[model samples]
Target: VKRIIALPGEHVAIRNGAVYINGQRLIEPYLSEPTLWRGMTLDHEYVVEPGHVFVMGDNRNNSSDSRVFGAVPLSSIVGKAWVTYWPPDEVQVLTTPAYAFQ
Candidate 1:
């Protein structure tokens, strides 16, 4: 699963199975490939509330995030994911999704 690397008040959407923030598609070089949108709604637009953020997992088809539990308030954010100590090959420092901040 991918961690939420960005915050609220940003425009986001999924198209052609790719995620776009603002107007450009995010180059998620880490993703296996284009993801599938399952159990995700594209009908209603969401404006993230102040001090809150929207989060989702990389496994879009199996994630239960803002799409299910709704936006997460900043106070609820336990902490930033700082490392990938497990699965040595996948170990690396995570970066925020750049496009999300555009």
Candidate 2:
């Protein structure tokens, strides 16, 4: 449902159709396609305020998230989607992606 993009105090921006943190680009190997942001206007860099997190949708261009609603308060997070239940044969557990900004 939601993908955590940038944590509090981190800088988040969409540049050249890719996500960047601080001044380094994030390696998002899990994404099947590159992000195509089309929701809100991100003409300027965004700095995540304390106690807030920047989130996005699995479907970037069509999803509304922090880019549209602004950063979400950390306290709003209740749980993470850990597994898929549909398609009995395709059931599986999901783990958060490890990002290395470089």
| Clashes by residue pair, model 1 | none
Off by over 4 Å in 2: 39-43
Provide the clash count, candidate 2.
0
Best TM-score among the predictions, by candidate number: 2
Residues 18-92, candidate 2: write the lDDT tens digits: 788897888877676767556545445789999999998877778889888899999999999999787989899
Cα deviation at 63, candidate 1, in Å, is 2.0
- Residue 95 error, candidate 1, Å: 5.7
- State the TM-score for model 1: 0.69
TM-score of each: 0.69, 0.85
TM-score of 2: 0.85
